[model samples]
Target: MTNPKISLILSAYNEEKFIKKAIESVINQTLKDIEIIIVNDGSTDDTLNIINSYGNSDSRIKVINQENIGLGASRNKGMKIASGEYITFLDGDDWFATDAFEISYKEAKSKNTDITMYQMINYDDESGRVYENDWFNLNNLDESFDNIVFSPEKTKNFLFDLSVSSCQKIYRNSFLKSINASFPEGIYFEDMPFFFHVYLKAKRISIIRKHLYYRRKHDASITHVVDANYLDTVEAGCELMRRFIDNGFYEDYKFDLIAYKINGPRMALMDIREDAKKPLFKLIKEDYEKIKKTKYYQDYLDNLGPKKKKFFLDILKYDNYTEFKKNNPEY
Candidate 1:
């Protein structure tokens, strides 16, 4: 009846093709003191049967069957049901390196940190080519953050640079509940706001330089999809802005917020559906217009290089997708 060292929450919605390997990865972890909580988010395929089969065979595996909620809500359900020292997430479409828990748990225990961040291995389904997730790339970072446990306030410089993906970090169970950390339900970028809220409040955060998880980027996953759901990014941005202002961290991370506001939508623009551009652009415009009146607006823009400066200029110029295409054409 002793609690496990880690609770690995697997969220799935018709991910039958990859669920088996995902389950096996946890069942075969180098660290055996772990509990596997599988949340079947109303999967119409054989996902439920496969999950039940694994649950029946393994005493440590716990399965929850529910109507389709969302990635955020499913994780919330798992967090409440989990009884472990620490909690981490694994998408049913992804698998972990066998030693993932062994390494991260050791770090979390030794450092006594609220959260331990690590790297992810992104593999293409068709090409079978593997590459490190860019979030942990040192060249992109201003400093080395390996094997260190530090407070969030002292390390505010790299706040926005970190990935919001929940799977990249292992969180102490009590610490997470203390802050009431929960992802925003029914949204695509649910992790964005949740990450900022808890990270800003965390007393201790640790970083690991090695790739500990494997993330599959197949066509069915959200990353490759081009649809209306991309509009959820706008709502996520708005929610994070509110959290920043209300939580008293707005002044400290104003530029970081601005930078993400400008760059985040631009990055998504390249992949969002053609018809979805105008509304997204309008929301971006409204957000940026308020930024224009701020005294530090020029200071933030002055620091940007030539290409980014031009990109912002184009963004500020047009409120409509047709006008943007007429002027820039290149995008």
Candidate 2:
């Protein structure tokens, strides 16, 4: 199908159980003019077999198999071979709303958007509690507008608040290729850097004021796991900030970048193992030391109150998470 309306890139690893649900969600969509590209990233389970079965039955489904190269690389492969006007990624463990395509694509085409953003629902498997994330709410403009569209530069204040997950946004294929936009390889926090790449290149952005994606949160999810790979958070933050500086956008978004770097990793750090606390804390302080050398660090650092500033400094003294948790008030 030449120039399919949308290309859905599905990346799967060992997600046999969830992959079926994810694929069905796409198949069940109201918009059927789409090509589903499923990348079976070296699945050591029945994932590949399941993917192949679907491809055999559906002429629109395309399957690619390769050794485990991580999520970012897998998505990059799909994007390379994509033959669609618009592209969006769907994790093997996640699903899209029935009208995600019809709704988002219509607005994207009408606005000529380089990037189309939408809200997401976080599904917690253990407790069966599902909640909507307002990161893509666009509340400030909702009262005056329905489908908000503009250059991200015009609303720089919303830059940091934008959703970093690829599943929450759709991109114009030609626009992404023109800017050479792709996910960062060899890192666990690839989403952060890739989102920054879009943030840097996107000019005309539009939004769907509805939840169009469902992200599963469970013990098996990578975000909930803690290991050496967790160290990639610091590196991802640095890469994102470095890109902003390289593109000459850092000075304008310095404070937000710095604050996100320090705070963004905190949620994952809270689940760090006892053995990794000291080493991880050491790196965190070292990361701050690197931040201090930046030209705008002092400008923003000075703006912080004495107590808030002390909290940053105080974190350096502790070698253990417990000691820090007991005495230090800062996260």
Candidate 3:
């Protein structure tokens, strides 16, 4: 048989409650010529059994049962074995809009882009409501530029503005393979670095305004549960900035990288307990102080947007929340 047009990799760990819905959503996609590779990462729940039930009935659905590795490793396993022209990822707890793959596949083909990105709606399970991710809305180009194909250099600023969620876009399988892209095996925030790697390696990327992905907002999700592992985001962001410098693309991407560095600690504080906030912020602040001494630091700050510059400067000045907030009222 011919390989499928797109390969959808779904990674899950003990997500029995939402696994069925997520699987069914894949089956209902408007794009039929696709393969679904589900990696059940040591799910203690009935997630493996549920995946088996579907895999038994559908030829397109393939399931991999493994010991509880992290999400990045599971996704890597799925991608290594994926047999499709294009590749995309899905969280086992989040479902996509019906035509997501169809639309993204067509766009990638027609525009000849290495990646095709679209917007996502954040679904609130408790409220049973869906809303556009405010971050995504900020990256939307004016109507005149809707459905535009942009070079990575052209969209450097927007890379920071747009959602870096892996599931928000579809990538050419060859493009990913050519770059030998893989997630950080045991990390919580692997997507951040992985996302940046893709953009940096790709020549062209296309963006459309359509909301193709639905990201469920629930406390139990990995992102919502704050712990030491949550610091992975800070580590990921720093590593991403370091990569830009090593590749000599730091100047072009410095503003966005600085923006990421500042916002990461702020967002981390929101989910973390009060007791952990101060220490975490202090670590971030000290790290930034060291980064500030680098030659590229001034260049990054010089290119930063006015508001972003103020927030970053404020973060550098104050480690405590009260002082930070007092000085940066606009936040």
Candidate 4:
């Protein structure tokens, strides 16, 4: 067969229950000339069997079976063998809208962008709820830290507040290869660091406000089942911070990004409505000290007004951030 224009890579682990639906979503895509690379990460379940069923019928579907390497490694493996000009990633449990690839491909071609990101909707199966789509409005482009635009400084600032999810974006294969980009192996937040690097390298990017991806909430998913391993995600964020600093990207946006990472886990723990009082306080104190010792710390702290400075100091003092939730219940 001829080489495909796009390669859809899916890193799956024990997704037998939803794998078929995910595959069907891709098989039914409105766009043609695409190949599906399904990397089976040694699922003990019948995920491989489901993939074989599709592979048997469709020449475009290729399956790679390997030992239970993590998602990052699986994606890297798939990319190595992909023959497409463009690349897109999907989780095994997530489904895409029929027109997702079609629309994205057309827009990317028209704009000659290296990356294209669109809106996504979160689907909660257990709660029977579908959250409204979260989109990036490019109409009033700030060209600053706030609005999503294509500048190194603005991109760095945006990473402080939000890290791009792989599922939401499509990347040009040539650009990815030129940057030697691959997901960091054995990392929990595999998408964030790599996404940041790509955003920094991208010359042109397109943001489509239409919701075209369905991010399903499953019980067995990693985010739902938190354990000690979840700490790896926090460490991954730290690694990204260190990388940014070493590369001098942190000079302008050090404080904001550090604050975001330092408080990220604490905020997550708070959202679960569980008491993380002691550990949270300990982590806050440790991070605060680390920040204080950094060269940029004092200047960043000085730039913060009275209220914000007190807030960081209070995080070190308080056992838990539950008090903030109490005052601002909506948060």
| All candidates: TM-score | 0.88, 0.88, 0.84, 0.80
Q: Model 2 scores what on Cα lDDT? A: 0.80
Whole-model lDDT values for every prediction: 0.84, 0.80, 0.81, 0.75
Summarize candidate 1's per-residue lDDT along 50-124 as a digit string, tens digits. 999999999999999999999999999999988989999999999999899999999999999998988888889
Model 2 CA lDDT for position 105: 89
Q: Candidate 2: list runs displaced more than 4 Å.
A: 136-141, 225-228, 266-271, 289-300, 303-308, 311-331
TM-score for candidate 3, please give it.
Answer: 0.84
Q: Can you write out model 2's per-residue Cα lDDT over 1-331, one digit (the tens) per residue?
A: 3689899999999999899989999988899999899999999999999999899999999999999999989999999999889999999988999999999889899999998888888888889898865664545445444556777676677677766888888899999899788888878889888888786788888777788888888778887778767877877887887787777877778767766776655644665665665676777777776666767568547554565465456565665557777785443
How would you order the candidates by lDDT, starting with the best? 1, 3, 2, 4
lDDT (Cα) of model 1: 0.84
Error of 1 at 126 (Å): 0.7
> Per-residue lDDT for 139-173 in model 4, tens only?
23233322233545444534554426888888888
Off by over 4 Å in 1: 136-144, 282-319
Highest lDDT among the candidates is held by which one? 1
lDDT of 3 at 91: 96
